[model samples]
Target: MAKEKLNYIHIIVTVYVLQLGVDMFRMSNMLAEDFGTNGWIAILIVSIFVVGIIYTIGLVYRLGEGKSIFEILENHLPKFMLYPFYLGVAVLWTLIGTFIGKHYIFVLQMLSFPTTSQSIFNGMLIFLAIILFSMGIYNMVKAATIFFFFTVWTIFVVAFYLPEFEFIRLTTHFFSGGDGYIKGFYRVFVTFFGFELVLLLFPYMQKNTPVFKATLIGHLLLTSAYVIASIVCFGVFSLYQLKYLLVPGLELLSYIELPFVERVESLIFNLFIGEVIVSIGFYFWGAQEMLIRLFRKHSKAKKAKKLTLALIAGIFVYSMQFDTLIQVHEMLHKLSLFHTAVIFGLPIVLLSLLFWEKRKEKKSNAKSI
Candidate 1:
């Protein structure tokens, strides 16, 4: 088997741009509701915390050098413990991936295709995930590079409606009472979920590259994009009005009309279909990585690919059994806590242990030498 290589810059761009899409366009309003007008401030605070986490996770990756989180676990922990730990991470990502697909399908049904069957919508999304997952990480990174540019173009197009934004709505004092800031900060933390990809992809990064710089730039880009979109949403809709909306970015675009184009939201919504696909693709890939690490025997390239495809298919089937969108959303919210714990908490712990072991190894070598 040949070792696979990816451009460091492309990975950085993909991580940041994909992060922008994961939450920026869909949940800005929900964030604003939690933080009020100061939601962007709360986002900045949460991002600071995220930056610290990314740095620590990057440190772990740098120390391990050329190994995924699973490989690191296998090296440090007993084999029996490795499988259970990896399985927990896999289940966490799978549940989150299913929820993302469910939410996207629900958005499509409500905003554009009211008559479409939920199964058909979910099936299409699963198909996209399978195709991307079938391709190796190198190809996935390439696809993400192309889609990253498209996401930038979409942002510019969405910006065209800025002049029409009602300033009063944006200026209204939602945070005037100075309450809910802590709650809003936590919600913003939840929105930055995809940063965990750094841990999963760190092993594949080019050697000697500045991982922290890439991570920082990516974080800045995503945070800026989210703030801009949140401001746009606030400007276009009153705080009170935005409270009831699920997808405020879509709703904001719904108000803008061009000389020839009447339904701008529909076009934006179509673009969202691609964004959601990429988001889920990354999650699926993360789960696949976890599974590959757990079994230990099937890390061969061909077998790994087969397992990834199978896992995606299995999750899609599970998604189809849910009868209502609300049920999926509720499950997703509950699962997110677990996802955060395993993806973020476990890495921090594992990395600390790895560092301690390395220090012990160094001390022993010094005594021997």
Candidate 2:
């Protein structure tokens, strides 16, 4: 049977949701602390870099003829070269996803499940992600699309907090002498991290789909959302309040007073559950793709998927060793730096090799002709 193909819309929705989910929970507050009133400026600046990165990703996809990075490395490089590079990609993605998952569990522990075992929560998330992966990538996109709608209204919900925002909090000294702006820029840069999933998703997209256009739209959508969220949080809280907040976007929702719900932030957090699933699902799919490609001859084998799930579980168990939020955040910051290098640096290396290979091929063909 021929494989199913995902549309450009699926890519847009999945990437946007994945990026938005991480930023709302982990990034918005850190951004407020880093840039103070000028955080949105950092977001905008980083967005231009993001657009360039997305374009490079699309170009690399074209150069590789829509193969995932693993497939490209396999075809073009030796096993020794391939395994280490591919393994790093897989492990980095899995670790990043686990860190994000840990944050979510910690949030739940503080807000609702103080006495419940976090292991249970962690296991449940892993179980759900495996189920989603088993359904296939098409279904992952569909699930993300559904979740996109479920949680997108949270953007509108942010408007409720606007009345409390002190507009004066927007700084005139956006690029002041303090290193906070630079630090904030780096922190916010990670918020743009999830869009690199395109490197893996390229092969799954429908042949005629416009990958470039889809990614451009997706990056812009995420940029708008992040900038708005940062602005809202900066406006709502002073420097002192924002510096201490673990999840400022969630905290923003705390100020909402709806006639129906007593604790509005709780409702918002519940809605974000869908987004968490989608974000983790994207990473899981990437890790699963790399794992299967590395070990199995056939990508579609049931055994490969089972092994992938097992590996994901192992990574999750290892991540649980970092019990405290501080430890998890510190580790994530280091990983984020590494991730920036891998996602951008790996593609440039591949693209260079692809270019050299193409030139060599043209010369050989010219002689043969």
**Root-mean-square deviation of each candidate, in angstroms?**
2.7, 2.3
TM agreement with the true structure for every prediction: 0.90, 0.91
Candidate 1 Cα misplacement greater than 4 A, ranges: 1-4, 166-174, 177-179, 298-310
Q: Please report the TM-score between candidate 1 and the true structure.
A: 0.90
Instruction: Enumerate clash totals for all models, in the order shown.
Output: 0, 0
**Maximum-TM-score candidate:** 2
TM-score, structure 2 vs. true: 0.91
Give residue 342's lDDT in candidate 1 (0 to 100): 70
lDDT of each: 0.72, 0.76
* lDDT (Cα, tens digit) per residue for candidate 1, span 1-369: 968765568667767745655456556666656766645566777888988887887687678774766666666678787777766776677667767878778877887788889888888887887688667677877877777776666566556766867777656455643347766676677777777787777667777566677777877787877777877777777666666787788877777768887788777667666667777888888878777765557547566557667766787788777867778767777887777677577777768778877999999999999
Tell me how candidate 1 scores on lDDT: 0.72
